[model samples]
Target chain A: MTEKIVVAYDGSENAHDAVNFALSIAKAAGADLIVAHVLEWSPYSFLTKTEVEERHKRRKEELERADKAIVSPLLQEIQSSGVNVEVMVKYGHIAETLLAIVKDTGASQLILGRTGQSSLTSRLFGSVAGSLAQVAPVPVTIVP
Target chain B: MYNKIKAPVLGALASCALAAPAAASNIDEAVNEVFANSTGWFVNFIFSPFPGTTFPWIVAWLVVAATIFTVYFGLIQLRGFKHSIELVRGDYSDPNDAGEVSHFQALATALSGTVGLGNIAGVAVAVGIGGPGATFWMILAGLMGMASKFTECTLGVKYRNEYADGTVSGGPMYYITKGFAERGLPGGKPLAILFAIFCILGSFGGGNMFQANQAHAQLTNVFGDFPGWITGVVFATIVFLVIVGGLKSIASVTEKVVPFMGVLYVGTALIIIAMNADKIGWAFGQIFDGAFTGLGVAGGLAGALIQGFKRAAFSNEAGVGSAAIAHSAVRTSEPVTEGYVSLLEPFIDTVVICTMTALVIIITGQLVIDPATGLYVLNESGSIQTVGGNSGVALTSAAFSSAFGWFRYVLVVAVLLFAFSTMISWSYYGLKAWTFLFGENKVSDLSFKLIFCLFVWIGAAASLGPVIDFSDASIFAMAVVNIIGLYFLMPIVKRELTSYNARRKTGEIKKFK
Candidate 1:
C-alpha cells in the first residue's frame, strides 16, 4: 500500500521548491503525491446587482482556468516522473482548505513552502504553513 | 429634590462666567455671509415663493410626485411594508446570489447618508420657520415618500449594468439610458447626462457641505470660536484618508458605524422624549393645530406645508434618486425586493427619527410661541427670533441641553461622526457620477477626490442658510431629471412587481433559513 502525502502548492517559486522536497520524501517512502492549491477568497464587496449575478460565471471560469493553466501542467510533470500523483483545487482560505483535503484524502503528511509574503500578509491573514502546523491532522513540513 | 442641592451651585457658576466673547458674534456673521453668497440666485430661483401663496412650487413638485407614486402603486408602501421588513431581515436572501452587501446593510448605508443632520437640525429649522404644524406634514410626506423610494430603487436594480470584470454600477443614469433603449425611446442619453451632472452637484452640496457646516456649528458651540476653517481642515484630512482608500475603507466603516450612531441618536431622543412624558399630548396637539391652521405663523398653512415637505425631502431624500445608487448594490435576485427594503429608509429617517427631534424641540418649549399673537415671537429688530436665538443645529442643541444640560457635548460627538461618515460615503457617490462623465481613469479619480475634500472644508466654514439653500436646490435638480426618467420607467417596475408577487405567492422565492 502506497502511503498518501499531500503537497499544498500555490505555483510560487518557494512552493516549487517544497514540491521537489516532497518528491524526494515521497519517492523514498513510495507514497502517492497529492498536490493541492487553495485560492484565497474574501466575498465581502460593494457590487451592483448585475456584477453579482455575473460573479457566478466569473468564479466558474476562474476555477476552470486555474486547473487548465496551473494544475494540469504540474500534474503531467509529476505523473511523467513515474510516481502516483493527482492535483486538487479548492476555493476558500488557504490553510483551512489544505487541512480539509488532507482529512478527505487520508494523507499521512502535509508539505508546503514558506511564501515570500510571510511578512505582513501572513501576519494579517495568518500564514498558510504556520496555520497548518498548528492544527493539521497530519504532521506538516514547511520547506523554507 | 435636586432643587435644594442645585440652587447655590448654579449661583456660584453664574458669577464666575458673566461675560461672552466678541469672536462669537463674528463667527455667525462670517458663516452666514459665505452661506448667502455661495447659494446666491440659483437657490433663490428654485425656492421662490408662489404668486398667491408662500409655498415654493419645488415643495409641490416632491409632494405631487410622492402622491402620484402612492396612487399608482396602489399604496404599495403600505402593502409591502411587512415584506420589506422580512426582506431586510434576510428571509428571502440567497447566499449564492450575486451581491456585495446584504439588504439590511444596504438600507443601513443609505439611511446613514440621509438620517444625519437633516433629522437633528433640519427638523428644528422646519419647526422654527413653519412651527410645530410642519411636523404633521413632514410625517405625512415621509409616509408618502416610501412609495417614491420603492419606485426608483426597484428600477435602479432592474436596469443596472454588470461589467465584464464582475463590477457593477447602477442608478438613475443606468436605468435612464438602458430602460429607454429597451422601450425604443429617444432622449435617454441626454436625460442620463443631466442626471449624472445633478448627482455630482448634489453630492457636493447636500451630501457633503450641509453635513460639514452643521457639524462645525455644533463643534464651535462647545469648543469656543476656533476659525471655522480650522475645523474644516481637520475634517477634510480625515475624509481624505478614508475616501482615498476607495470602497474598501468606506464599506468597512459605514457598515459598523452607521447603525450604531443611528441607534445612539434615536436612543438619546427617546430618553429626552420619555423624560418629558408629560408634554407628549401637548406636543401632538401643537403639531395637529399647526398643520391645519398654522396658528398665525407668518405664511399660515402654506408656510408650514412648504417647510414640512422641503425639510422632509431633504431629510429622507426619497425622490432625489441618491438612495437608488446605494440600494442598487444589495444582494438579491429580485429587484423589487431591494425596493421593499429601501422604503424602510424614509420611515426610519423622517417618520421616526425626525419626528423625535421635532417632539423634543416642542416638548422642551424651544419654539417660544407668543400668547398674544398666537404666532412665533418676532425679534426687536423685526426679524423672526427662534427660541434658541438661531435656527439649524443650534436650535436642536438648545432643545437637548435644556433637558440634559450636558447633552451638547454628546451631540457634538454625534454630529462630528455623522458629518465625517457622510463625507466619505458621498465621495463614492460623487466619484461614480464623476467617472460616468470623465471616464474612469486614475487622473479622473484623483481629481474628483481632491475636489470633494476641498468642498468638505468649504462646507464647515460656511453659514447655514446658503449651504442649506444650495444643498436643497442641487438635490432637487437631481429629482427633476431622475423623476422624469422614473415616469418612463414605472411601467417596467410595475411588470417586475407583478411577476415577483405572483412568484412569491407560489413560494418560488423560497426562504433559505
Candidate 2:
C-alpha cells in the first residue's frame, strides 16, 4: 500500500521547495501525494453575496493558476517516477486547514515550508505550528 | 460603646480629610480653572491667527476640505478597504523587489508607530469630552483617512530613494517633490519642503515626547512612588538600544511585538466583552445617542464631532504622511501593495482596538453625566474629570480586572510593551526626518538619537498634561501640510491604481509566493 503524504502549498518558493521535498519523500515511500493550499477570509471584504460569489470565482481561477504553475509540475515529476499521487486543495486558514486535512486524510506524514506565502514573522509557527504539533494526528516535517 | 465608636469614626474621617487637603483642590478643578482663565488667551490666539472667529472658521474649513476631498477623490478610502486585504494576503508582495522589509513587516512597524497612545489616551480624551457620540465621528474620520494612508504610502514607495547601501528613504517630502516634478507641476519643491518641516516637528512632539510621557505616567501609576527619573532613565536606555539600531532592528522588534501585544490586548478586551455581553446593546445605544444628541457639555454636537474626529485623526494618523516613511521601506516593488496593507492600520487601530476601548468604557457606565452640572464624572471624586486623567487607563484596567482579576497585571505588561515598541518606532521616524534636515552622516544620526533619548527621559519624568497637549497639537499640525500634499498628488495615486487593476484583470499578476 502507498503511504499517504500531505504537502502544504502557498505558492511561495519555500513552499514549493517543501512540496518538491514532500513529493520526493512520497515517491521514496511509494505514497500518494496530497497538495493543499490555505486561504484566509478577511472582514474588510464586506461584499454582498453576489459579489462574494464573483470574488470566489476569481480566487478559484487564481488558485488554479497556482496549481498549474507549482503543483502540476511536481505531480508530473512524481508520476514519472512511478509513484501514486492525489492533489487535495483545501481552502481556509493555513494552520486550521493543515491540521484538519491531516486528520481527515489520516495521512502518515505531513510536509510544510518553513515560511509560506505569509510574512516571515507569522511563519515562525510557534503559535500555529506549535498548536498543530500538539494535536496533529500524524508526524509533520517543516522544510526550510 | 456607641459614643466611643462614633468618636473614632469621626476621628478617622477627620484624619482622612487632613491627609488629603490637596484632594479638595482636585486636579479636575484645577484644570477647569486653568481652562476658564485661558479662555480669553485662546480666544485671542485663534482670532488673531488671520482673524474673524478662527476656531469655528478653521473647523468649518476642515469639514469642507475633508468633504470636498472625499468627494473629489471619489472616496478612495472605500476602494482602499478592498485593496488593503489583498495587500496583507501578499497579493502584491514581490520578493525580488528592492526594499528592506516585507510588506507585512512594514505595515506592522508603521502600525506600531501610529497605534499607540492615540488608541488608548486619545480615545479616552475624545469620549471624556465629546461623550459617546465622539465614536461616530471618530469612525467617520477613520473611514476618510483610508484615502490619506493610501495616497501617502503609494507615493512613499513610488518616489523612494535607493541609497548605495541598499537602504531606502521616502515619504511626503519625496512624493511632493518627485511626483509633482515628474508631472511638471509648479511649487512641488516648496510644498515638499513645507511637508518635511511639519513632519520633523511632528516626529519630535507626537512621536517622541508624547510616547515617553505616557509610558512614564503608566509606569509610575502602576509602580507607586517610583521616581519619575528612574522611569526616564530606564525607558531612555531601552529606546536608545532599539532605535539606534535603525529600521532593521525596528522592523524585527515591531514585527514580533505588534502582533503579540495586539492579540493579547484584543483578546483581553474580548474576554471582558463576553463577560459583559448583556451590556453590549446599551453601550451601542449610548454611543449613537451621545454622537447625535447635540447636547455635549460645551458646544454640543459640533464640539463632540470635532473632538471625536480630532482624536481619531491623531490616533491612526492615516493621512499624516508619517506612516509612509515606514511603508516606504517595504520590500515590494508595487507601491499600491503597501498602500493596501497600510489601509488595515486604521481599521485595526481605530475601528477594532479603539472601538473595543470605547465599548468597555461606555458599558461600564464610566461615562456618567451629572444632571446638575452637565459634566462627565469619570471617577468617584465627583469632580468632572476627563477620561485621559489616568481614568481612561484605570477604566480599561478595571474592565480587564473585572473579567480576570489577575489580568490587570497582564495589561500593565501589555501597555509597557506597547509603549516601548511605539517609542522605538517613532524614534526611527524622527531619525529619518532628522536625517532629511541634516545630512545622513553618522554624527547627524547620533545627534538625533541623543536628542530623542533626552526627550524620552523628559517624557518619562514630566507631568503628562502639558507635554501631551503640545504633542497632540504638533501631530495635528502635520495634517495641515500632509492633506495639502495628498490633495495635489492624488492623481498619481489614481493612475497607479488603474494600472494595477488592469494588470490584475489581464491575469498578468501572479499569486503571491
Which has the greatest TM-score?
A: 1
Off by over 4 Å in 1: A1-144, B1-35, B98-100, B245-251, B372-374, B380-385
lDDT of each: 0.80, 0.66
Docking category of candidate 1 = incorrect
Model 2 lDDT per residue over B64-94, tens place: 5556656765776676566666666566654
In terms of DockQ, which candidate is strongest? 1
lDDT of 1 by residue, A1-144 (tens): 679999988788888889889999999999989999877754433333223334545666777888888888777777766778888877665776788789888999999999787488888977777888999978999999
Taking the tens digit of each residue's C-alpha lDDT, what string does model 1 give over B16-101? 22233346446546666866775688798878878976678788888888998999999998999999988877677654442235
TM-score (second chain) of model 1 = 0.91
Residue B353 in candidate 1 has what lDDT? 94
Candidate 2 stretches with Cα past 4 Å from truth are A1-144, B1-69, B92-100, B245-255, B371-392
